[model samples]
Target: MSWAEVGQRWKLRLVQVDWYLCLGLLFLLLVVISLSMGAWKLNLIVNDADALPIEAVAIRGERARTSDEEIQVALQDLMKRSFFSADVNQVQDALEALPWVYQASVRREWPAKLKVYLVEQQVVAHWNGDAWLNIHGQIFDAPKRSDIGALPLLAGPEGQSKVVLTTYRQVSELLKINGFKLDSLSLSPRHAWHGSLDNGIMLELGREDKMARIQRFINVYPTLVKQSKPVAKVDLRYDTGLAVGWENAQKESQ
Candidate 1:
């Protein structure tokens, strides 16, 4: 055959090959979509039977406030799904949603089981008069109990939990050096801060430079307390000096 004729034949063969490839790809895409949409329900039944079915769930963690029953209840829906089909993140979220759970991890075990590890919240202080603040500064609510009332109280505006927690830690450490214990700390709506000591002395740390003022008070606290009777309150809003409300005498400055 002539060169041109050979070239035409080769072009026609290439076109035929392309057409076959396109048809094959279209068939594969349709199959995938059908399977995804559950159009072929029989395949689902067959695959589910073949997949590793979750026969048991094992929960491991320190449980003080949260019970095993609570965790089981949270994972009830997960138990319905097979180990391969259940969402690990969803299961973890469910467990963490519990009042006492601080964090949770869920993993699939070999041959049909789920292993869940839980970390319960460790209450550090009373928050906002209603909730509890964990060691990580997260706020959570639980049923009131007598033991919780003894914890140091911390109050602040919404979305200020971390700020309040930080202040509490810093102030508590500073006061500890002076042999005093912080009982409660509050931040007012006007951004003013105040604290009560275990000895019934109150501190008014005004809006700006609260930590600085508190430190200043700490520096002179020993001398001030020794010079006079135990005071009831100290106002640390001044730039150079502080005002003290004595237990019996009029307010004095130092």
Candidate 2:
């Protein structure tokens, strides 16, 4: 209200601005000097990377023997310190390119560091062509024999591999509950699904409401098993009901 009060208010505002300026300069110095120091230098100064209280490599693994192009792009983006405008996506995209990685999510753990969460690829199916499909429906070359798992094998066209892999999982579970074993499943380009049973029968399920059809099959499997029905194959595609071809009289007697 008075000139003296106005002067006091301006003085306080100037002090706050000066405080902010000092904090900004301090941060800039840390980025320029501290971050510029190499891994060796940091080891000499800080007891550990975690002790630094800002940057920490949460996961440590040899960056999955990839080409230099992808690694260089990831490293360059990580070394940047502009803070607000660090192209985070560029860094994440680079990391995601690694064959061992299924999905990678990057988050700024603020005041200093970035956190990376990698859902490493878990090979669910071993493809015939020396490759595997990750749980995320992504395909990558299989690791060494020591690294590959004893999972089921799936083979199909390149563009349709994922669809086949995912659908197999669903149908295989369906069979397991009904005390049946699955051989393999194939997906046609026309969106039709077919499967083979371990008992040497080729079952075909046409493209349609998959859940409803599978539910119907699950419900009727026990009856067929009880009738000792020699079911060679059970086709659930027909609108009326299931069509089961006879397997043999031995199963029928049982």
Candidate 3:
């Protein structure tokens, strides 16, 4: 072919390729749009079918401090959302915010329902005369409860609850064996240990050998009880022997 005629034919072929490329891109765009619309329609259908919302909330756990009304109140807002669209993390957080709920789990039940399992806090002692201490020695503030007044009172600086609880348990066990009931325990800012018995006797355990000092008190309790006046306080911070403060002495002085 002539050079001019060959150049004209090559231009036509290039134009045809460009048209084919545009058509292919247009076809791919349509397919993507179709798939997206189909997905959106499917989601709409699912939501329409779930118009019933969460009809029931099944709570499964051993709850003593957390009441049924409390759980219902916590989940009131979450129940308005459809099961398919409900936020499980938000539900879990709401339930966990209850005063007694230590941990919570939320899951869908394959229908228009939600399942919530809650773990309640196990209160072991009163902390700082205001808050509460769980068995794990974690501090949590709760409303003033009349039923918890019988629990042992434990006091110490912040972040030392576990240490005070451990010492309380150890010393309480020792005193209980000798018929002494430990009513309260305190850790001073100087790291001294002190306690009060149910019988109104105060104990000064000092900074060291608390167990040994408690043991000494138990050993001498009988001898102290046989005295003429009742023992009001026992100071066991010494290396050997202890000081006894008589209750009547104060009464007579007064």
Tell me each candidate's TM-score: 0.73, 0.48, 0.89
- As for lDDT, the candidate ahead, 1 or 3, is 3
Give the best candidate by TM-score: 3
Q: Model 2, 1-254: lDDT tens per residue?
A: 99999999999999999999999999999888867677557555454334444343344333443445644456564544343344568667877877666666776666556666666667677765587777767778735556453666676776887778778888888778878777777666677877777877667789986656777877887788787556777788987698887777536767
Worst 10 residues of 1 by lDDT: 42-51
For model 1, the superposed segments whose C-alpha errors exceed 4 Å read 1-53, 145-149, 219-230, 248-254
| Model 3 C-alpha lDDT per residue in residues 2-96, reported as the tens digit of each score | 99999999999999999999999999999999999999987876665356477888899998788989888987877777778788999999988
Candidate 3, position 157, lDDT: 96
Query: How well is each residue in 1-254 modelled by candidate 1, as lDDT tens digits?
Result: 89999999999999999999999999999999988778557556533734656788888989788887987798887777766677899999999999988889989888788898888889999999889998888889888766554889999999888888899999899889878899999888888899999988889998888878888888888877796587888999999899988876644333
Cα lDDT for residue 69, model 1? 91
- State the TM-score for model 2: 0.48
What is the C-alpha local distance difference test score of each model?
A: 0.85, 0.69, 0.90
Candidate 3 — number of clashing residue pairs? Answer: 0
